[model samples]
Target: MSWKKSLLDWWGSAGYKKCSEKNRSVLKAAVSLMVVLFVLAIGVRAEKSVVIIDDGKELAVRTYAGTVADALAVKDIVLLNNDEVTPSLDSALVSGMAIRIDRATDVSISVDGRMLPVRTQCRVVGDLLNEAGVAPGPEDEVSPALNSAVTPGMNVVVARVVTKTEEKEAVVNFETEQKYTVNLPQGTTRIAEEGRNGTAQQIWKVKYKDGIEIARQLVSSKMIAPPVNQLVMVGSGLVVSRGGENIRYAEAIDMVASAYTHTGNNTSCGVAPHYGVAAVDPAFIPLWTKLYVEGYGYATALDVGGSIKGNRIDLFFESYNEAMRWGIRNVEVYRID
Candidate 1:
């Protein structure tokens, strides 16, 4: 029989109906599996809401990425070598997740006479120094301040300051003092105690910055050896004896004595020129003053002569022969008050 005559015979047979029912059940199972697969794909691609804090700026983003790095890559954000990122790039992303990005800056640091270039993501100067492993001393000074905000291409200087005390020796000058006493002769002086210079210690506080001196202050000064004062003794009194009597004379002088007899004229004081009357320079001995002469006994200065100048005296005699006998000689004359 032909193939068309065979198909007509099967249409009337029970085997064809059983095969149709089995094919319908297989199509229903395929449709159910496809629906479940589509639902699972939608769940895996669901968008996640996230917050990104980039260099202190807030940004909201929704991504279907599976990891933090994937999310950032989808947002077209590029990270530099020195830039810092929170929640490492490999961490899985979650709904409502927060991401932080700290951008780095280039800066120069001057410390201890050296310059160093560095890149950091710190927010303040203090944090940058700590990151660089630079620990400043308590007395050190920092420019721009530790709490100041760090900026790109900024220059920071650290001045190394130090304080120290120093001790030094100095010379102390001596002083002089005078003492008046009657034991020393008049118009004479003597050094009773010698003078000597002493030593002193000076303490100073000094400050230095960057190996250079900045300031110095004298803290204290003390005498290490006291100076010895010079003591000088001066004379103020004199005494002498005259004509077997103790005379309290004020002054004495050695004078050249010349003798003169009666000149048959009155003296400069209008007194008679006789024994016990002497002629002297009024500048040396005032008129009417009492005087005691050695080897010539006592006399009164009652006259003045033209040649009787300083340290010269003329004595009166009873006769010219006696005047000739008494020539010129040095004699001590005392002025008695």
Candidate 2:
């Protein structure tokens, strides 16, 4: 049958006319059901919700209009060099889509007060400082020791020390009063002993002024040589004896601190070649005063030079040559300050 004739013939039939009211109602219901099915089949659809992880943060993109790229751009999610994403930007967004972005960045860290440039994925406090070449000095004090936890900003410091040894040479002048007896008489040459007199030592109290032998008053004197009085006949006018006889006389003693020659060059009254023994003339001279001798010229006594002590002077000679030359000569000394 023709499509139009079938539709008209069905409409004119008793099934259509006798039950027209009921049929009309049923037809209306059927038409409404068909429209509802059509609308349900193809209509505005709801977009899937997309979850993207970017820069360590989760971003939700709901109602994604187009592709994954469009979704990201729509959500204002920009991709950086170190950022990572799951289901790349080109992938289409689906329902409950999860996109993950791993973000990494170049960071400069200050380790123990020292600025260190490094690349790391660490987030804890202990691992950062070890990567940087930073160490603490032994004496340097830090807020936290080497084992302490490190943070973004920390401080450190260091300390140092130096040492030295020194040596110095000082001279101390000293003296002692001494008296010796001579057998020969004054102005007259007469050998009373008939032989040369041997040298004798008599200790005396000697005073020093500023490490110098100023005045030596004899405290006591003893005759080391025997008494010898020679009777000489004078032919011309009688010779008058101005000075007293060289008889047995006692003199006061004066002692001054003095240093002795440590070097075996034991020549009395001369400079010592070495720093053997030391003494000081506390009465007049201060310790460590330099001295020069006049009668016996040379660097004889170094005040407080450790030996040549008290009134007893140290006479310096060129060598042992003149040392023996001026062996026991009574000489005057001068202070050079």
Best by TM-score: 1
Off by over 4 Å in 1: 1-66, 70-78, 93-100, 170-199, 223-337
lDDT leader: 1
Candidate 2 lDDT for residue 243? 37
lDDT of 1 at 268: 85
Q: Write the per-residue lDDT of candidate 2 for residues 229-249, one digit (tens) a residue.
A: 333321222221213422221
Across residues 181-256, which tens digit of lDDT does each residue of candidate 1 receive?
4556776788999999999999999998988899999999999998999998766455666566775554577899
lDDT of 1: 0.85
